[model samples]
Target: MVLWENLQAVLAQRGVAGFGVTTAAPFPEMAARLEDAVASGRSAGLPFTFGDPATAADIRVSFPWASRLVVVATSYLPAAGSPGAGVPGRARIARFATRDHYRPLREALEAVAGLLTAAGHRAAVVSDDHRLVDRAAAVRAGVGWPGKSTLVLVPGAGPWVLLGSVVTDAELPVSEPMRRTCGTCVACLPACPTGAIVAPGMLDARRCLAAVLQSAGWIPLELRAAVGDRLYGCDDCLEACPPGDRALATATAEQGSVDVSRLLAMDDATLRAEFPHFYVPRNSGRWLRRNCLVVLGNTGGAAAIGVLAGYAGHRDSMLRGHAVWALGRIDDPRGRGVLTRVAASDPDAAVVAEAATALAGTLTG
Candidate 1:
């Protein structure tokens, strides 16, 4: 108890959004839920979603002697009056990935772990890493309640807080769980642009635009238009959440949007370097370029036709394929002309197929 009190003071002074403690007991229910998701094929695209319930539920698996788990929260909200990333010819970035929020959250957790270590107790920290169900830990810790968006909504920060935790062997007091719930509010459900949130607190990663963008294969034809101008991550569901919204006002979801034309202009290394925290498959920029082309198609209009045309000849078949879709989305004569050339000359069957689809849409519309 004394150790917890000391940790609380330390966290408060460090500007952490909030902190709470829970027993490091096995979360059998959470494990069962994940098991059901994986077995039922509900977990898609998210690699961490794999494995049996034990891996997802029990903190003891990772920290064999852990007796207490200290969950921490840090606001990811943009500072007031800060410049936003949204622009007319660019794509929007989710508020979380606008920058590295996890770094600070981890730092805070490490601080708590450090205090435990100095007291001769074993301790470890984790954040977005798959070792722990952070939201479940957070809920048990009484730091917050799970909101309809599947995000932990803190008392003052809504779903705008990033989560991390320190697992320690110290037998600290278990936190009192929050009594709050979203009640009848379900705004996050309909706010999902791609209908990714099929129900309250449930997410279908396959239909999630952010997850799809991070995926390795072709962008599903049915979902391309919903990608809109989003270059990375989707915040619509989080944005629609109304609890603790006073703190939410400072974050501009558009703050991290990148200039699609400028981003597409960069070489592969530069593009990945520009967003160090983004989850690009294979750490490759090709997927990012694929996303940009889609954004250009949705919102680039006449100004983006030239850009789309250039990508139509890109060496990567995937890029060329997405570019074809973008060209069709722009529907400019010049873009269509590029698609015509691609339909005839492109070497990849998939690219040609994409071109055929894009061109067919033109004829039918």
Candidate 2:
């Protein structure tokens, strides 16, 4: 076993606020899911091929030689009233997404990896991908527990934290998983406008606003109304819980409020410049723009009509389609002309169909 003092000192210097270690075991479900993930990604427009198992079996096979799975938690929650603070209209980016935790977390994990490698031990660091739910793994690792809202809530950090795991061949002291502390709290369930959290600890991701906003492809119309002005992940469930409300309020009060209007107005260049570390840019800005359109439609006020109209003729097929949908929601007469124009001229069949449908809805309404 490695000296606990040395490991703790290393983490302290690396700025990791809290961490834990768990035994790496054979997770059969995870392995099967990995195979399906690879096959699906191959046809799902993923740039590169992912092998059946993302995590090498060697890690588990050599677990007899390895010591522990070092899990780390970093405090990414902004201080109260920080720039990330506010409701959907103000467009608060989740603290984790805004600061871009992957790289910094990776760097910190690497430092720990370095220490082990130098000691002639094997180590690997895992970060976020579509397949692995890092939060679930963290919860199982004893760093936290899944709350009513389906977010991993750490004891001190609440749910406003991001997790990363370092699986190593070296065994270290381990921490027990935190017990479910929800204590019959049902605040998050009622708070979800779409009822994505039908039951505690069970999240239908398809209905989860956060998952919906981050998703690629067309959003069904039925869910749009419930999505509200949320340009990205929905925080209502989180905001409504007592612990969440208090934690977010405290964090935001310390940090300045986020401005949704400013976020909507940011062009591609400004977005890249402003949110250099953000995950939104990685999607090439299409999903963000689409999400903004949904929020604009939900606003349904004169202020957003012009902006929605402006995007009606955007070159991006996804942007144009969402613009047309937003125009339908706003019921702006001016949108009729733009929709008709797009309906006739857009090369993408899906864009053309959406525009035509929006035009028809406006004329009939």
Instruction: Please tell me which predicted candidate would have the highest lDDT against the true structure.
Output: 1
Candidate 1's residue-wise lDDT over 245-317, tens digit each? 6776665433565688999999999999999989988999988898898888888888988888888888788
TM-score, cand. 1: 0.95
lDDT of 2 by residue, 1-365 (tens): 45556777888887764677777764555455445645544223332212434443224553445556787777665532344432434554544555465665788788888887888778887656432346656776787777878777776667766677777777677788877678978888888888777667666666777777777777777787776766655667756766545456556443323454566578877755766654553645667777778777776455666777778777787888888888877666677777878888889999888887777877887
Question: How far does residue 320 in candidate 1 sit from its true spot (Å)?
Answer: 0.4
lDDT of 2: 0.67
lDDT of 1 at 92: 82
Off by over 4 Å in 1: 80-87, 252-254
